[model samples]
Target: MTQLALCVMLVSEIGCNRDGLVICYVVIPPPDQQWGIKLPNDTWTGMMGQLDRQEVDMALGPFTMTPQRASVCDFSVPLHHENFAIITPRPKLQSDVLGFIKPFTVQVWLLILTSLLSVATAMGCVVWAEGKIFRHSEKNIVARAFLWVFCTVTQESSHWLPKKDGSRIIVSFWLLASLVFMSSYSGILTAMLTLPRVTVTIDSLADLVSQSALPWRLETGAAILTYLKESKEEVHQKAYRNMGPTIYALLRERQAVAEGKIAVICDETSMKKAMDLDFSTTGQCHLYIAQGKVMTNAMMSLAFRKNSKYLVQANHRVRILLESGLWHKWIGKQVANSSHCLRHPRLDRREGIQPLNLESFTGPVLILLTGATVSLLVFLCEHLSHLYVQPPKSTA
Candidate 1:
């Protein structure tokens, strides 16, 4: 049995005899010496040491079965399987200041702008040709063309109308195109603005290594470190290299994660405990377990002294417990009884509906201001040009 209460309960339940006789000795190792690691002094410590000396009949905890450890002791059938994962702070809601523009990518926005300009220029040329052939006033054709295009984009009525059939046809096509463009923009923008944007910062180990903005660490003496160092995968190598040099204790790592100081790479079981602790205290689930699994089939089993007679019985009983779904039932009950901040994270209430600010309307507001400024400049330029052309007519 280990000092971790969950591990103690699990092991105690597994070791119970059919005669209702519970005859198992439990040893609590020093806090820093829970798992055995061979020291430079040619001596082992923790549960493995106690088992090696025949001081304890069995060692039970989240002890993973490694080739090195198996050499010294026999393992019972795995009580549970776990994966390596990263525990990160829950992503914050993205600022809405420039969120309105998130509906389309930069290339898309540029394409739309290019299309608008091309159509406006084509319409202006068509209008100019009609005026030239029919000898009608052709003044301000560019301005009128742009105004018509703007109105189409905004779905607003414009005073200017195309007289000729050819120009009308062009205008008709532009209106259809504008309708589609506007509809897509409106739909996408509404969804982006009204719905909260949740971001997963580190989805995979590769992502964890590539993103240098967040410092990441692992608890000292973690089993996953050995896996990372020996992994053939390039991503794992990179992640190992990028990990912070200073190893953190479990509580220190959890605190760092909660305070947004660092992200931690840990096993799923430990991650869940951290999450439970966080939720219980803060009344919010601030920690998120990354989706990526660094290593799978990491079997956790009870360790016994080499060729111990109890190994056979223990393996059989544990297998029975697993096959009968008792282990899963216990795990489910543990999770269900654990306090959670949200029943359904996606559907749960968020920091209520944030009041919409001017920043939230940045895209449309900037467009309106830009259009007004351009219109004012165009009006001033036209008035000045007229005055200059009229010369001294009033004086004469």
Candidate 2:
């Protein structure tokens, strides 16, 4: 309803014959605008009357389906989904990683907790190794401990190990600590590699609430907001906002806006990206969908005034152009070419996404080296301890 402010046309000559005869003129719609145009209702009402009389070829705008409008004009199947949202403001916060993990499902929460635990365990092992080996003062204990962690976990080269003359027990413990660190790190890495990545699953407004108590956010001008507000369930469940300022506030706060608390109010695609779905959200979020069951999944068709088969044929050609998948292929290549555009730049790039090197380990060598190292260290510790620390002569 909002995209019909002005009209212009391009006139061109038709034939190569020496005679100059302009055959057709192509009318172009005006630039898009939201508000600030003034016109009386009768002006548009009269235009529609003329359109019914075939005085005009067509009118294009956001014209949703209704019985009255259908009587006067034919409509194309909806081009996309026009789902509503409940937008609200985000809140301020300090760094508590648990805030994100706590509201999710068991699997999601487990992954988050496991990551934290791995980091904590690695830090602990490094601290133990540093204290046991280095004669460094406790004043610089934290710095040295972190350096050991940096070298060991990442397998970086460092000359930090104590001389062989140092206490054998402490050396043995460093070996033990390294084994523990690698085992724990590798276990988590394996779990991650084996699991399939998550994708966007929420499709409908109802699905949002069904999955969790996350609040929905809607913009003031969003067409779906009006429809959602009319529905008793949606109106009660969702929160509406004028813009992103308030929406961001609720998201950061982790509270539902319905009860005047902050929560994330984003479209499904945005949610998917935040949750690491298949692809990043970049294209159009709003869509126009046909309501009737028969037209469900139907391609959005362009309508023409009655008895104009030419326009219908032209629309069909456009549909064929769209469905050929050339556009999809082109978009995919562009994204791959700029792989940096995707999230997790350091993670694996299975899609030929450019230069970010994935975490590389020679699989067989890594596994064998890890196993042999752990076994050698454990056996050496047990054998040496048995030989040196003799059972105290029973003073019997």
Candidate 3:
């Protein structure tokens, strides 16, 4: 789409008739032969090499603009700009039956606990001072205050509320805070149990490189590999170090990612293509593009041989197409073609309407078993003690 638009722009700029303009693709079946322009000895190689040899007038695609690529061929103003998106297996769903605790972080839970303890202690102390220091009729004021506060935590009704204004004020604030916690926790936990909980295992390029869980691969002869190999940054260096063997084709490897065998480091174009193809073909979305970007400096433009006569005109035409919004429209059109499967981003999210089954609630099942076992043990111990205390009142 972009190429056709650029072709029309070029023709219009030169005031040449549409028939006079010619566009041809140097077709190569080998995926490896289509990308990267570098090699010691080259005789009519990939698009980059063909550009360098001046065999082809221009090469198109998201031809990444790098210093190494720039030294061989002149690039028009970058037409498409992007960073590589990591494609990996979705992180496993958390069925931690105790996932009820997950609605709040550890710090938040601790804060709640601290607040509860502080309020209970203060209530007990204040009540103690009132009954002990002053002539107030009270029995076990400290124990009763603690019990009332504990009961409040469980939402249990109690008749024992403080009579004094200061005590009542403290209780009121505690009630408000507890209500807030309960409302938020219940809403979140319900949503969690019903909806899919997506855990973004890899949020950045560094996260992908630092983790050794899944072996990651790159496309053979990709400029991303070249960028990583030559990059001075630690994350890129580590990514290069940890990169698995390169594959000529990326589509076949999508299954590997789905099966949790490997991850693919690819640009958004390839990522979306794979995702759409997988979903369209299988009717299931097993692949996901991570939210991380590998290289933010990557650019796409028309690649012309060094000092090619068309470089100046091509840049002008490219600029006109970009400014006129034709380029973005074409890109958007291409992306919109795969509108069928819209996989939510982050940790391989599923459709929002997927209802979890009993098997999925492994955490809750385990809790139930533990509770049953504890009850059985307590019942056995109680029976044993009863028999010891009153010998069953001998039948004889």
Off by over 4 Å in 1: 1-4, 13-31, 37-46, 49-56, 105-107, 245-253, 337-348, 351-354, 362-396
TM-score against native, each model:
0.81, 0.31, 0.69
**Model 3, range 1-396, lDDT digits (tens) per residue?**
233344444434534323666444343333345566476664334677677666667665557788788888888888877678788865655555557678899999999889888899999877766666566777877788788877787688999987666678889988888888888888998877766565767767888877888889987767888788888999989998988888754676878887889888877766666666677678766776777678775787767778877777667767777899887776665556345544554334555666666756777688789999999999999999988877556666
Report the error of model 3 at residue 59, Å.
4.1
lDDT of 2 at 195: 35
lDDT of 2 by residue, 40-116 (tens): 44222322343455655654433334333445556544323322232322111122222222234588546645743
Q: What is the lDDT of residue 24 in candidate 1?
A: 67
lDDT value for model 2: 0.38
After superposing candidate 2 on the true structure, give the runs of residues whose Cα lies further than 4 Å from its correct spot: 1-56, 59-72, 77-223, 235-237, 240-299, 303-310, 322-396
Which candidate comes out best when scored by lDDT? 1
Model 3 / residue 30 / CA error / Å: 6.9
Please give the ranking of all candidate structures by TM-score, highest first, separated by commas.
1, 3, 2
Instruction: Kindly indicate the candidate among 1 and 2 with the higher TM-score.
Output: 1
What lDDT would each prediction earn against the true structure? Answer: 0.74, 0.38, 0.72
Candidate 1, residues 94-121: lDDT per residue as tens digits?
Answer: 5465676788899988998898899899
TM-score, cand. 3? 0.69
